[model samples]
Target chain A: MAHDRQPPPNPTSQSGLPLRAAYGIEDVPADHRASIGILPGEAPFHRGCFAQGYRTKPWRIFQLSGYGKPEDENERIKFLLKTGETGFLMEHDRSTADHLYNVDHPDVVARREDVGMTGAPMQSVRDTHLCLDGIPIETTYGHAGGAVVQHGPFALAAYWTVARRRGLDLASLPGTGQSDFFLTYLGCVTKQQVPTQAGLRLNADIIEFCGEHLPKWVPVSIAAYNGGDTGLNAYEELGALVANAIEYLDEIRRRGRMDITAAASRCGGVNFRTTMDIFEDAAKLRAARKMWHRLLTERYGVSDERALRLRIHVVTSGSKMTYQQPLNNIVRGTLMALTAVLGGAQSLGVSGYDEALSVPSEHAHQMSVRIQQILQHETNLAAVADPLGGSYYVESLTAELERRAWSFVDEVAAQGGFLATLDSGWLHARARANQIKEFADEQSGRRVVVGVTDFTDDVSPFVVDGFPGVNDAYDVALERLRAVRRERHEQGARKALVALEARCRGSANIMPAMMDALDQEVTLGEIGEVYRAVWGDWQTPELV
Target chain B: MTAGQRRILLVKTALDGHWRGLSVVAHALRDAGFHVIMGGMISGAEIVRAAVDEDVDLVGLNVGGHTLVVERVIGELRAARPQLPIFAGGVLPPSACRRLGELGVETYPPGSSLEAIVDAARRLTQVHAEPDAAPP
Candidate 1:
């Protein structure tokens, strides 16, 4: 049912901030005007991070790649790398990895056919090794597959153990472990997960361990992309992200072991999502950096310039990709990728054209890389950093976003903090409200999604049926789990698990024991058992 | 119209818990005056049991995984209750959609509007308002 009424004269940003037809110097807020002249690479880096943005270092072409067996995922990763992907992200099966269950778990067995539909099932370090078989660990920047909170230690330990096996120094290893709260608590909540408090402790332990040993590794990335894609608006995404960071930094400071600046620097490598709202999202990124700088200086009283500048990895919003005319998503991907470049992202992953249907096929994955390649090579879009910095409209919108975002941050803080809000389901309620509003907007014709609403008919001959990951993932994973249990030294495995359980029980770091456990072939389910026994499961807040 | 009331059982065939689509559809179904039972992430046996126990007129399976699992679930449901119509949604590829359609299940993949889904629910369950009943 299309709306017959005329549209309102004045429109607003996606976050509900009103916009004027024209903006001038008067429209730019006074406080923001002072920083308007500030250059990239300077303090409070709203403009950008590096003065010579892509010229000095082009944004890394990092794409999420994984599914099926470990070998199958490795093949896809190799394909992406050959097609000019600068970095690779390993994704683990949600059925196995997100829940920390082995292939034989009753829950997984019930859905055996769905085992590796989302990502590879790496139940043990051997499977992780197979996933990284030919990939170079020392030089290439890898994202070890631990997107879930409870799974982070095992994934990171597996990656590190593999590196050590290759005789690589832990200090020189560079990769990111995504133990993000937004993913764990809000976006894709697993059926069973450690409580938020336990998750915080695990993340702190990872950060501390990384600081002491794997100095180059990004201990944990705060992916607000999950929050945004799950339905938090632009301003709320920024505010909630900052709130999450505050929780991490405050915990680290309370421990009083590691220096806060290093902890802040570790937290700097954050991720955000760019949607079809190009200008607003680009403005959101700018506001994000500035808000991060202000948070560090104002709240924590830290002056390390390196720690103030937030590094961003933008993944174009997958929710924006329509499933109707799947080919149209390629253009959407390009536009969103351009926004990320305009926003001065350090790295970017374009959501595949078939995102609405399934994980990217080989062709769709290549198209994702090609879209970034075209932007980086053909258009010269990366020549100047923060290209949208000076325009009156963009500047005004950026300042407005920053002001509103800070206020939202204050609101979240007033409600006890990010994790508390998540535990209380307050954030989920906000996201659900936005989801309803957005859906209603589409239904009422206020927001017309092409192909879905307006252009319903398709004339193209090509059919996009989505990627069908290998059928044998479940069988192979089950065989490998049996092999690991049978071949590994049973006594050593039990001892390592006992040590890990002790570490989990006490206040000490759990990584060393975790590494030993993985090295001894302690399967994922056993570790999950230990966690369940010690910390217990988080009571997932109710959501419709 | 049914004599007493029409009910629909919504269940997830896999363990993935992203509920944005399911929530919208459930709200629309409730608004349209259907009894909506949310069966969160249940097995094929559990789904069949729930369908029989709740006496649902229709079954909506949120298929987020392999078609084989969904096919099996649909098979079990059909075996248990021959008359219960089934519809599916969530990340189903075109091939999977076609396969499910072959099994007599209407498929609403991503990008299907809430109105279309609600209309599908009504049509599938054959639940229409009585002239004397109050408006929704």
Candidate 2:
């Protein structure tokens, strides 16, 4: 029920690329170099990450699941796993985890009812344990919920400590902690947290700590999906993600801690977002791998083939889901999932049909999982590798995207770097410009957003209201925090906090102290206090 | 453009620090000749404090969390200034929008145009006509 309207004589993609009615061999640009002859899994691995693709290793069906009390999120995780999810991502409550405030903190206390609206409030190891109650972390891929930069060390340590207690080897454990800058600094800026320089230290520490141990863990995934959904167009998202990788590699190199090759491999597991711009978004994934290869080989002088291949996790853009006709988003999710499959994403999460309204209901989440299942099994998607490999239009778009992205990379470089752009509000300005333009396009009927703009004849009888969430989330979390504080051995917790504070102040890897702190049952707020004392707050630039 | 230049205070009810929506609304209001004060990720007390301190004509809220949180903020604002008009936009579900609407706060969910939001700001502010609010 969308996109059926006749074109406006001239149409452009979300990134402002002029559209055409038809294409041929000549449409593929003359200046565009040959990715045409390169095979999948080869150098400049934009075609596909693997030669046979889904035949060898199917893309991981990863979904972000959490809300309310620890047990509530735990039940949801178990349900997702039971219903054929390949990996689990634990989401920490934004109110508590994002700001590193326990439920009892004054700011959190001010808004008590909002505690678990975004995610489960996991304050200590016990809460994390309850969240992972029956999940087999040793065998399965786990996401320790540290999407915010400041909370990374605490979140990872809590998850790792739980694994160690279950007699799982840290070296063999497979998981990731998203110490992503784009999520906070660029996308969702926290109210008060460590400055970007300190956040870089936290991420670098995680990388070094994971390099020495936890070989299987993707230490800190740069989820550029945050940057993308925030308002970055396709090429800008690709360019900014590359610029972020450069920052990580440069820091690791400067420290002379781990081999840059190994660091590149660990940092390669990044993320991007797909929206309603189906073809452009699909081209984005293709452009991403090639850019990674170019960045590592041309810039970093890295040669290891294993380290060169970029493993991407694609999340369908959440902002694209409309509240006007919520059920239409199910179709939106499916099409975006299909785009990811076409683009050869290594992992994917389709935003729920009720995404604009609230966190996905049980049924909404199940539909998210089912969307991927149907794509993998019912369709013949898994039967081919690089199915769009030879399409003239796709290849032209791929090359066009790469060229435009490199220019954007240069644009970011002139702003100092990705992190500098973030700090200076340059990146936010770019995102804001694009956001205003896109909104204006929709407002002027230059863009038709299906049920939102043109086709508004939705007649679904289902009452698809947003998730109400558990009423007792705040009370239960408050009780849990009190219980942990009252029950944990105080002296040990104090010692660990002191040590963590020292590590934050000194030039030491903060992970060991963080792990010890978590093991000693130190709460999230204590760690927050230490970081606050050490780094102070990031003065967010004037956004309005 | 109106009886006088209107001032609006935009505050985020939750600590979820996404400024995209708030910034867009502020841009539109300012473009339409309203003085917009962006209160970044503040609580109800802080929001009320800003509204009263700034002596703004209208208060615009950006809700990223629960309806209850918005309700609490609405109560605080009402207590502080009875004549103050409040309008909200963000990730408000239909139910949350209805709940907030029942409290006399005009709710704009996702997909609501900037035109509608700016129009509401003008209308809500004009409804709150006080002799002191107009710039002499």
Candidate 3:
């Protein structure tokens, strides 16, 4: 099976725009006068989000920290904090946490050695407590370790339960929980997650719950980073993100539990990925803010300027980092970070050089932090907001992305909505189509990723025998699950589980019942058991 | 040359569902005329069952977890069908790649080209094509 491939001799942008020799007056005439008058803080905010960008609030250095046992994750968080990390994201073990299984579940037990490969084993609240040990939850803007939709309620409730134990007020506490459909349904599809319908209900419940209490918490951030990394192009990423937001807002409206404007505000904090394409991706951030503002105003009639402002967090593309010359990824990480920074991101996480191999080593984690730190301190890049605001090339690209993204959103709309696309594998087909092209592009030498496709020779002295995380993560997690099962009040746990099962089968909010379950020290797998019984499993669409 | 299509079984040994890489490989192999059976994120026992039951000439394991798990899955596959030619590609670190290579399972870590993977698949299935070859 050979391909009669046509190698593109000339350079084109990742979004398929052929490069021009130079952009003079023809790119955008009158671009610098009236259109450029829209400053950083103005409406249709493609320029920037804030009046003063990193000057007022520097992008949060929020590298995800986890691995090994609970305490190991805690130690790593503290280490990151001491090493100039402004914020931390708790990462729950993917096998146990993402699937909402305990270490003892038959599925998890099959490959027990892989239990803590990605993150800490946060089965019960006790384990969550251990993961959050000594970390200042009151002051810190932390991610509560629930990246999956089904797992979000448990993760948030457990974190809030700990905050309550410390006598902190819920209204004033600041943090976020990512009940992202992209992570759950698209990027890393778990074995048996709740269907996307159930996921939307869970996320909407979180939004309403957060509205009443936990006012400062960004309940469910739509992380299009996962979608982009999975192979959605720039405009597609933007389109899918907003389309995803509409699912949440419409669900909340259907419930009629909270104000639509308030719901829009709660879900405004979004995440995008910055890849190697610096100008286009930066323009994507600009386009994203503009699209978000328009979506809130035109659709929902959101009048609050603050509610209209979309906060952006950029996670540098992990799949972009090469495995051949691992150290070369440091430069890749730095460049992606700069792309995010130049795009006026409110937060950033550079993928560790050893990202493809395993969880970050202490050194790799430090390097991730240093990359952000260097951008913030040494580089004068953050001195002004949207420094590339008036550039004819950037503005043109931003408008082009906005035009394409809206059309993508409309395509999603025609297929019912975002969740419908996931259910029907429509979005997956789109991603796979792009994936084929990307691989073929590289195969035909149209794309030259250094050390992977073109510069195949490596002469570096540095040997990054990728970090294999803690070996005892499984053993420790198994013991802890057993101990937690043994130590907690059996009756209280049973009572909580029964009540939780009732809510899952009924129409009431799942968060209150979830909080009760967390209060009674119910294990993640127990809640998972109830969910599986009540909701059954999501019939995952044919992926390949 | 084999008269029928060269069948290849691609299974994710670990439960983690990072299947984008696996999907691409499966697509590439299918394009190259191998009968690619996606066994999905299944257990070791299930993977072995699929390999033997499907009578695949080559097995591609998407290692989303530890090499130890992959090693155990490979052991199961080899025990079930001693003549099977196995290969792996996923989040395999340098050491894990070396470890799997020692066990005669070719490793394609991240950034591996589709051309190389397809070539490896053809070569591996060819090596395991005949019935009287030395046990792998």
Cα lDDT computed for each candidate against the true fold: 0.90, 0.89, 0.89
Alpha-carbon TM-score of each model against the true structure: 0.96, 0.97, 0.97
Interface RMSD, in order shown: 1.0, 0.9, 0.9
Q: Compose the digit string of candidate 3's lDDT tens values, residues B17-132.
A: 98889999999998888888989988998888887788788899999888888998988877778778999999988899889999989999888888899999988877664453
CA deviation > 4 Å runs, candidate 3: A1-8, A29-34, B1-3, B129-136
In CAPRI terms, model 3 is classed as medium
Expressed as tens digits, the lDDT of each residue in A328-347 for candidate 3 is 88999999999998898999
lDDT of residue A522 for candidate 3: 94
lDDT of 1 by residue, A1-544 (tens): 3434456566778878898888899999988888888888887888998888789999999999999999999999999999999999999998888888898999899999999898999999898889998998788999997999999999999999999988999999989999989998998888889999999999999999999999899999999999998889999999999999999999999999899999999889999999998899999999899899999999898898888889999999999999888899999999999999999999999999999988899999999999999999999897888888888999998999888888889999888999899999999889888988898888877777888877677898988888988899999999989999999999999999999999999999999999999899999999999999999999888777
Predicted structure with the largest DockQ when compared to the true one:
3
TM for candidate 1 is: 0.96
DockQ for all models, in order? 0.64, 0.77, 0.80
C-alpha DockQ for predicted model 1? 0.64
TM-score of chain A of 1: 0.98
Candidate 1 C-alpha lDDT tens digits along B19-51? 778877887787778888988888898898888
Measured over all alpha carbons after superposition, the RMSD of each candidate to the real structure, in angstroms, is 3.7, 2.3, 2.9
TM-score computed on alpha carbons, candidate 3 = 0.97
